[model samples]
Target: MFYDSYLYLVDGSYLPTVAPTGLKTDLGCWKYHFGAIEGMRQNGWTLWTVILIRLVAEEFNFKLSIMGQGDNQMLLIEFTETLPEEVTVNQVNQFISALEEKLSYIGPPLKIEETWISKDYLLYGKFPIKNRVALTTSWKKNCRMFRCCNEDFPTIETSLSSLAANLYAAVASDNVTQPIFFLSISDGHNQQFSLFLVIYQ
Candidate 1:
């Protein structure tokens, strides 16, 4: 059995070609990849989801958006970063306001559904979201907040680069007796890089 998978990145970017099994005939094989495939039963492809993974820090901000119409819809935004030394009420207000404005632009009626802030190390105190009553109320109504420890999530670029490099390395090794190859492409002017790996048994 073979399968073709599509991984959509944070910036709504994706690689066009099939992955893993590299079969492009139909979506039937994908049932084994994503268990309980929703798009399969509907007779229409409706499973369009994007993963938002980022490392946030002081003066660091990122935005992501995905708009579509479907029965199974979900949008989640997460930021993992070290705790800053000091954060002002004004700063928090500004961040929330900007997030609200950005969410308004999404085509689907998608609510945040949840918002979480977790701390690690010697910080075990109440991180208040009550500074702005209106914003807090809106958040409370639309989002669920939670507290926990920080986790490390890979950025899309790092993940892609690592995957391409590893695949190339495996094919280039002496142990592989198969006639397989790969190409590392880079456009120096545009600062774009891509690795194409083709395998034949």
Candidate 2:
């Protein structure tokens, strides 16, 4: 089963963090995931974990993290675990409190904006467009835009770095005169959404 959760910044200016769930593992097995976690920690980024619980006939628990400084940063971490059927609100609050306390030593205090417990979601992908005229002319003609699953997206750090590099390259080249921004479109059923990063002249 593939479990996923998205954390959107309330401001809507930055790309939301997408976390695909991973199997729960023990601390002794940290070597498997520690490299990525440690690299972010060493770079002075704060990590905040968000837990999403879905309750139906059975309870499904998904964990993901947000990393940043002050209020403008995000990252992804994934963990999957099952909660006891009889868990109570008090127990859940206690767990969250403990998690926040544990993470305080490493960086800023963990702030959880919200918890999403929904069964319906839209699978997201990315499609890049290089021509502005093609979008205005005909959607049918531009059907060949490159598309890939969300899991295939570069890490937030990598995406930002790449965007910065591209901006610098565009500035240095006299031939490049287009601006880039993302356009997200959802299907009528809202079951799937695609993000188009358009670079137009």
Candidate 3:
């Protein structure tokens, strides 16, 4: 027989014959690694990226984190959070655009990316320019520069770090805290909204 076949006794009778084909069992070792998480943790940082973006969503926060990156290409991001049901992917993108507009003072346009994370959305941003040293502090009274199109961005009242970490902790820890600065865009009075951000360096 050209093909292998099994023979078995049925009703006290021999069934069939078989060919000489055979199979081997040993399989070579497979090695897989995720250097991203390992490196981030070692560098005293972590990426809080979202894992999923669902169709019908409600009550959540969503953003990506690039932490302790030594260079531009090698970045580790972890997205984590949920959003209210009324918000859609398109609306989130619009909000991201607004943030880009607000941070225009930093220079270079922002390149945005949305990834899926645990039935939620993971928002990521890439600055067109690189090698910019970033410092995060609470809104210091001296460096506060916040305002809507109607009013100039007020000078920050806390260090950028303090403000940033507080926001991250609030969302990461699920504790709500009023943001120190809000941007209303084109108008400062009625359009204001608080936000938490993860800056890439």
Candidate 4:
């Protein structure tokens, strides 16, 4: 759907090519331009509602933002839109539950916390292992797990790079006909997440 600043008012079924007149003269209109995702359900193309849940707070004129912190590590999302009225834990959980329902394939582990400042909430989330190249019916045992963290140098990037190279090396050594894969989770900083590299021969 194509729209100017009045995106909230546009009908979802309207095509982008049929943009109304004066659309080009509107200020801050370009920011509202959205493209349709190919696989989304019918009549459900809203960006915040369908994909980016973090920005949903904007619809209510509240503050919702994310940042990477803690020694250049860890992703933190803060929601601080509620004022005058108290924001309950149940409300936060309901919001998260809605997101989880939309993103169920993202795994089951999620952490949520509320700050003492009232109405401010923090959510810690992670992306699960995606089966990009193969079907992941179940996780196998005996997989090697590596943890490398807390370094004065660029440990996270180097570790991840080395992990990828090592997987290729292992595949070559074992003469495996199938593809070998590894999982990498980084908050883009000091903390190192669990890395599991498996070679299926």
Candidate 5:
């Protein structure tokens, strides 16, 4: 009589196992690589992103991290964690998207512009002998062109670096101590809401 078995190393412990012939460790596995965390800390992910990842992982019992690509000098995040109850995969994906969007907006202030329906145009007769009609009356018409304002504008910044820049400007210069512009898009108003950051120097 003989016994056929196998062994698996988990957390530095070699445990005997008698399971299927082919075992896929990638699926439904708790992969905890300290090196991955260190790599993310040194390179790709910010402190906020790391904190957010930890928070999300703790809240949802998910394991995710930024892994380095072999010899490519690039890093990527591998998300392989089950979400909480009633949460869809898209919601989990939105976490990554939000991080990326925030990172992209970190460099400079974002300018928001309002698009106005300026005028309408009408076409009459055949294509070969068509005449263009420009409507100037205060009546309903089709949209032809959009007019964007260039005078007053708004800007948005959400990172600490931007805050530092604003603070530095207030201390270093007097001309930059005026109203800082910002904007927000509101669905209720169906327009761009201009916001001003008044720094009293």
Candidate 6:
């Protein structure tokens, strides 16, 4: 239930928390952490599997991981370690294969990666949908339905959670009395993600 929103694996070598349990708990104990990390060389299969469903369950709670990226802003997650040879370590691989299998005619694999996400990237807070934006159980991260900019927010510095909270409060005043969004940022890692409800007037 807690493993939704945007999921990522902090390259263990660089992340402050070698285990990456998050601020709420230690990594060894958190189910989400355990699901994603498998000793550094690979992770994020199950974490990715759980993202959408978790977002749909209640309010949106975002998850993030910090990894070192070069000036190109690209992150290379070596899928080399847990190659999808066996179903045991192939959870994410299976998830991707199933989805791709279904949409085989759609012209791609079921799994899609963000070309590069930057510190300055404003995820769920970038636009006031519709001028008509709608969440409608859509992941909507890279969808043209919401506005994403080519610009990047400065990774070295930010206050995204506060900003997201303010935006949510501003949007949901009447109907959704208790909508909540939880955002956790690595004080050191510089990546931010938000989970927000689209208030329908």
Model 5 Cα lDDT, one tens digit per residue, 78-166: 34445443454554555545544554566211121311111122222111111343323211111111122232532333232334444
lDDT of model 3 at residue 160?
A: 39
- Where is model 1 more than 4 Å wrong at Cα? 1-84, 88-93, 121-201
Tell me the alpha-carbon RMSD of every candidate: 22.3, 21.8, 25.4, 18.5, 25.5, 21.8
Winning model by TM-score: 4
User: What value of lDDT does candidate 4 attain over all alpha carbons?
Assistant: 0.39
Clashes of each: 0, 0, 50, 1, 2, 5
Candidate 4, residue 119: how far the Cα is off, in Å: 6.9
lDDT of 5: 0.33
Model 4 lDDT per residue over 1-201, tens place: 543444332455433333566344333334455764354433342332333455333343334444433211222334454533335455555556655554454422233342222332332232222322232321221033234433455455666665455444445444332444423232222224333222222
What is the descending TM-score order?
4, 2, 1, 5, 3, 6
Number of the top lDDT candidate: 4
Candidate lDDT scores, in order, read 0.33, 0.34, 0.32, 0.39, 0.33, 0.33
In candidate 5, the residue pairs with backbone N, CA or C atoms under 3 Å apart (3 or more residues apart, or in different chains) clash, namely: 155-181, 155-182
Task: Single out the weakest 10-residue window by summed lDDT for candidate 2.
Answer: 49-58
Off by over 4 Å in 3: 1-64, 67-91, 112-201
Which residue runs of candidate 4 sit more than 4 Å off their true CA positions? 1-51, 55-61, 68-85, 105-201
Candidates 2 and 6 compared by TM-score, better number: 2
Q: In candidate 6, what are the lDDT values of residues 110-165, reduced to their tens digit?
A: 33454322223322433322323343322222121112223364322234444444
Instruction: State every prediction's TM-score relative to the real structure.
Output: 0.20, 0.21, 0.19, 0.22, 0.19, 0.16
lDDT (10s digit) by residue, model 2, range 171-194: 443232343222112121121222
